[model samples]
Target: MPSTVTSHHRDIETDRHARTRITVTTTADATAVTVTGDLDLATSPRLRDRLDDELKLRPRALIIDLDAVGFCSSGGLSVLLEAVTNAHARGIPCAIIATQRAIIRPVKLLQLDRVLPLHSDRAEAETWLALVARLR
Candidate 1:
């Protein structure tokens, strides 16, 4: 049986500026990280840390929900790329979900979607994951 993992939520403040909310939910199927707020220079570190922690769990898949992310700078984009690389190295499938144009525009403009494996919704993300499954 897979051990249960609790959901983690936190507010990160940097330079008394941007705020980012990161929520990590782990289960037998997959570990999901939902990001809300600006993912810029100051806030990117917090997201990176959260992503690293979730990756450590080595879940069946890493799903990043970026729908609520209003802004994503290079720092934020880099974190997503790094997460994908790390997940691949660990043999864990990864998917990024974004429904809003705010986040998608930058990702597409940078051509990050090619390497990031982005989806408009969780359903679509899962549909794209070839071998991942919910064994429970």
Candidate 2:
């Protein structure tokens, strides 16, 4: 089991002058980081920080649970991209659990689907892991 690093919600004021709320949680295995709430420019740095720290732990996989993400902007996309790039460089896999279009649309639009695997939910992510395990 991964340890919980921090869990809380905060308001991030964006350059567009929009106020967004972001909730973040990290588990002990330090492999999964669940983000709930809005993800925009102002709150994206927080995500960057969390991901940077998690990568240092060198987990086999990184799971970003975004099923509860309410909104996302380019900054949020950048953070996701950063994580994916880091994962690729380190030969680690990153999984995204997202059901909402708001979260999925951007990833698809950017064709990041070609890079990082996205799942509809946690169960699906686990299933993918199992498949990968069998394949290996």
Candidate 3:
């Protein structure tokens, strides 16, 4: 089951399990994606699509808000890595919001924290994006 919602030029997609939802919102300087729910094998594809869609827009910065994520598997991590790689290849700055230890611990264990800067909240992530845009 796939469901999509479009609002104010933003595209939102929810997976069949209804356990995962990805909301993509674009601003003048950045694209912000909010993920809510478990990000595992069953829902990683949805996230990949959403991220790819946002990247296609070629925004100056990409901010992923993962504060609501309860779990993330290797498959989900792969999707994230792909997104970061794609963004970097395009010279787009990417930021992640992972205030929860459940989300932060796995990323840190994999040393992904070094490559993907993690923020404590959406505001901080947005600020980072803004600063990156200003510098570039």
Question: Which candidate leads the pack in TM-score?
Answer: 3
Worst 10 residues of 2 by lDDT: 7-16
- lDDT (Cα atoms) of all candidates against the true structure: 0.79, 0.71, 0.81
Cα lDDT of candidate 2 equals 0.71
Least accurate 10 contiguous residues by lDDT in model 1: 7-16
> Across residues 1-136, which tens digit of lDDT does each residue of candidate 2 receive?
2234553333332334444433344443326677767787667887788788778878766788788788889888888888989976887667788888878988899898887688987777867755664565
RMSD of each: 3.9, 4.7, 5.7
For model 3, what is the alpha-carbon lDDT of residue 92? 90
Per-residue alpha-carbon lDDT of model 3 for 10-38, expressed as tens digits?
A: 54867756567788776666678989998
lDDT digits (tens) for residues 47-135 of candidate 1: 88888887887788888999988888888888999999999899888989997787789888978778988888877876666445443
Clash count per candidate: 0, 5, 0
Residue 75 lDDT (model 2): 86
Best-to-worst TM-score order: 3, 1, 2
Supply the TM-score for candidate 3. Answer: 0.86
- TM-score of predicted structure 1: 0.82
Error of 2 at 124 (Å): 0.9
> Weakest 10 consecutive residues, lDDT, candidate 3?
1-10
Q: Residue 98 error for model 2, in Å?
A: 0.7
